[model samples]
Target: MTTKKQKSNSESHERKGVKRFESTTKGSSMIEFISKSETIFLTSLLFVIRLAAATWGIINDCDEVYNYWEPLHLFLHGEGFQTWEYSPIYAIRSYFYIYLHYVPAVIFTHMGLSKITVFTLVRVALGIFCLSGELYAYRAISKNINNTTARLFIFFTMFSSGVFQASSAFVPSSFCMAFVFYILGAYLNENWSFGIFCVAFSTLVGWPFSAILGLAIIIRMVFVKRHILAFIKISFLSGLCIGLTQLIVDSYHFGKPVIAPMNIVLYNVLSGPGPSLYGEEPISFYIKNLIVNWNVAIIASGIGFILSLWPSIGRKNQKGVTEYVSPIVWITATTGLWLLIFWKTTTQRRTIFIPNISIYCIFHCTYL
Candidate 1:
């Protein structure tokens, strides 16, 4: 009787173990499925946002590109690669940007891609690029700080006014922001190959000022290094390689190598008020213009700017990453100073777009 009872109990125990194993396996599969589904949903959502924004910008600003479109059409139809007679006036400034439009023009010509479709594709690409940078920044920050805060910071940054306006309304600036993030990520990881690729691609994207952001990262890395000499050597070599590549491309196309339009704008601002500015204007003029045109963005940014500074006030003994705060502050300050200087000199109110938008994103991220 004892042996039989013991055998029965062993069989019962084995059955329970099997059931548990099956339950664990099922749970694991379910979790995997949910994770994949979530990823798909998020990706689709972002793509849609990008598409919508791009389409809107293209529809509204179609006239902006009309002058360039003729030449673009000619290039697409394989008429000739030589500069069009009208190219000097419209296409002279943003040759790099115009160059990229060639691919979309070709696609449109053959595949029946509408203006809307082309715009959507470009916007989607830009959005993905911008988001990728935010992701990289979040990853880096999370590595050094709490994961939750880092994620929140990234979310704020991505949705900030700077990002939204640049991605949605301004193509060149949006591309610049993406390149900035890419370079930042690569530099932070010390991935020389990836960094160079990012820089080259950014330069190709037609915003040389974007390279300034990259320079900032390189400077930061050098500052943190144990051997300043080695850091300088690497930095110089990298810059040289990038410069040479840019020179080759410029030689092949335009007679002279030129920085992007934003840089030109910056130079104009720095060089005292050009004709764009009616006359010498106070810096307040630019500030007022920003507040008037981008009220929502300005309000959001103002909140963010305040919050970013909040941590510094009355917090002495708080032992944490104070170093992280410096870069954000410096970027904001330098950009703001530059903008204000320009505003004081130039009457061209449009110049406010880049700095205001950029600051808005940075501030929003910091505050949020």
Candidate 2:
């Protein structure tokens, strides 16, 4: 019962797949089928780069020191700066995240490491965690997309100054960025359970706003693929488990019942003063920041996003194409939606880091 258009689309995909395989095989040995040894070497090289950033990268925001690192320091040393967000009445920040990082610090400290050395080691752990997510995404990309895009993703992720700035930073946005990598990889690989759990984990344990990035996955499963039963079961189970853990941990830390995620969402989104209490900026603030961090890649992302939309729109009414909208379109459109939401509001550079992770993903979609 396959229609002509469906057959045409299938053949087109097969042709592209063959062309990609031939080009990767013939063009560069580096992008050839990655062997175990090459993966090991790549991991080691990337680890060295990340460790250097953890050791030497300057703190770009006071929030990193005051809001995150200091709370973690207090948990370890019995003293550190306290921010208003940590107050019991507000309780917008979660101690669950702090406790997660604390495990590594305590381990290093037990080894007779100095406090400074422990700090560096803790940051190194963060870098390693972030790197693991990138590696996962790289493998997924190579398997599901093409080796060329995967290679370029690795290069851009390694060399980008923004990665250095945020990779090891002890902040929720940075942590969420790692989760984003896993989410993107899972979406592309169609690992529904892992992807669902990651979205819950990022929203519950890291940043609540990060749930925006999961919209694409939700849409694909619920509306497009129509895995309604599986989606509900997985999302509810993961959300309940992670949310319960976060509630218990954060409530204990604050000496009261506190839903830290909801509290944060209310504060930032519903409160009258909100983030504007600190300051406000023109949309150019993020534009300048993105330009500095990504340079021409930002422009390319915009162009690629615009180009990606055409295919999805064209296929919308095609009866035989199983997926009317490409998953890449879902992803890029969500990122674009995020940009529009934050652009008109009080935008922070740190808040945009999760969305920024999608730039490389979008850039690769252009090749498709």
Candidate 3:
């Protein structure tokens, strides 16, 4: 009878243990669901905010006129604004980039939308497109850093005027910025090919100078002893495809075979005077711009970088990765270098500096 009692007690304890195991598993799954649902909800809300920003009226540069909206207008209505910049002789501007938006406008127009409505819709579309790039970068940041730091990055990026200004603007820098997102995203996600392709495509089809973003990553990768050979191959193939496609489409428009990228390179770089010939500024131009645009964020980012190099200030991150300085820190540093060197502009310019502000915020929290 004692033996029977012992067996019965042991069976009850085993059943209780099984119940606890099930309860714990259920709780973990619920927590995961809540986390994922919150992320989706927040991302959706952010998307809506960007859409509103697109429809809002903001004065953009004339380049947005001649380079994008104008070309698109002519393509759609058979006549619109034109500027000397698009002259066949120079071929500095791109129809390839314009067509990306033009095709969308075409579809929306076919649905009986007015030109103004179509244009507005397209603007919103472009804004969403740009926002996705930033989101990709956010995901990449989260992967490298803790959830807390990543959340800080998002909060800062959401309110940044520079991001709002650049995201909806129908310009090359704005367009290239999306590719910049993918490049950074792919790099952080460990997709070397997608990252290299973004860099190549942005350089080929958007702004040539945008390739500078890619160069920073390559240096970082080499430093970390990653696959340099694969990056080179991916870059070459992507650049070649983009170049060949651009040549074919542009040749038809210009009425002669023209290498637009080279024309831009020679005109911008090899020319004796450079872009400074048109408009120039003192060193204080950018300093003023940064103060006006991203004052708090930059301070945070500055702190973050300091923390990364010297980690004694904070507890080790949850990942047990003590020295995991985000590759994106280099982006802010490199882009800062670019701005310092080229403070002078051919036109009145506002530095499109959204990413750094986001970076600085994350860095601020990370190190502190």
Candidate 4:
């Protein structure tokens, strides 16, 4: 009888302990780092600024006008410039991407809005998408790193000239930049499935090359966290869904089965001429561009990178592997690899590094 009574009490205590732990973890995750009013005020400020950019932002790249807006215009108005890439023979550009903007244009046209107003509204929609990604990243940084770093990230993203340009641009690279914010946020929040989906969606739907940017997260999931099965399962499912949708939509438009993302990747990566056929710039090109857009923040970030190295360089986990250092180290490595690869081409721009600017801001606040 005494043994039975003690066993019952021990089992009940264990159950209560587990429940307490579950509640504490849940409560901590829900705790707001910033007050509600502050969130509202910051959101309003970002939207107003993004709205202004949408209303007045210049089409800095002719590619934006021809490759995206023109194709979208042709889809809606039945007449617009069509680049060689849109040829049925090449089918390099995905009509599915254009289709996303098309639905809104159709709606605005039906509403009797002017072409210019429709244009502004479309850009405004891009701004909202960009803002949501930024805010999510901000929250993730607060939750994963620190609130101060999150605030600094918001400040840099809101005011940077490059962000002002990229936030509303109608280009795959710009779309990739916004998706990257979501990817980073998802990874930091430890939402592995969503992060994997973002990687697949961004690569297949937004920019094919951006799969490289998500490598760190994928690597950590497979090797470090030992979530290889989940990674493969989520990646295959997301890729299948996104890839099939692209094939269906693109095949309908091109008059044959087509995988536009794969085609672009093969052309850009495997072809003899590749992107170099267009033009090439010296390494100085990207440096001057970053200096102009980010100014001293770029230098501060460089210093922060060095500072980050000091703390994480020799760190290792239980397995005694150097690869177990801070996640920032891995992120930094992939980012540097991206720069090395992209700088060799003329097509690379400051806009491609918009998410990196957020990372830089995090480094600046965390280390400096």
Residue runs of model 2 more than 4 Å from their true location after superposition: 1-32, 312-321, 348-350, 358-361, 364-368
Look at candidate 4 and give me any clashing residue pairs. none
Q: Please list the C-alpha lDDT of all candidates, in the order they appear.
A: 0.53, 0.81, 0.70, 0.82
In model 1, the Cα lDDT at residue 12 comes to 96
Candidate whose TM-score is highest: 2
TM-score of each: 0.62, 0.87, 0.82, 0.86
Encode model 3's per-residue lDDT on 1-368: one tens digit a residue. 56988999999999999989978976765454347776797679778777877888584687777667888999998998777667897787777777778888999988999977897888789878877877777777666544565666677667767667767778777777667767766766767778788877888887787766676578666665366787678778988898989988888888888777777778878875656566666667667777667666556656656656544433444445443454545655565565654664523445444333333344444544
lDDT string for model 1 (136-201, tens) is 655544443334545455555545554555564434555656665655556545665566566656
Point out the higher-scoring one by TM-score: 2 or 3.
Answer: 2
| Model 1 alpha-carbon miss at residue 59, Å | 6.0
Tell me the deviation in Å of residue 244 in model 3. 1.0
lDDT of each residue in 5-64, candidate 4, tens digit only: 899999999999998997897566547665688799989999999999999999888889
- For model 4 the TM-score comes to 0.86
- Sort the predicted structures by TM-score, highest score first: 2, 4, 3, 1
lDDT of 2 by residue, 1-368 (tens): 99999999999999999989977765664446466886998799889999999999888888889998899889888999989999998999999989999998988988999999998998899899989988998888777666777878888788877677678989888888888888888988889999999999998888887888899889988998799999999999999999899889988889999999999889888986777777788887878877877777678768767776666664543235556667777766666677787887764444575534744554544433
| Candidate 2 weakest lDDT stretch, 10 residues | 359-368
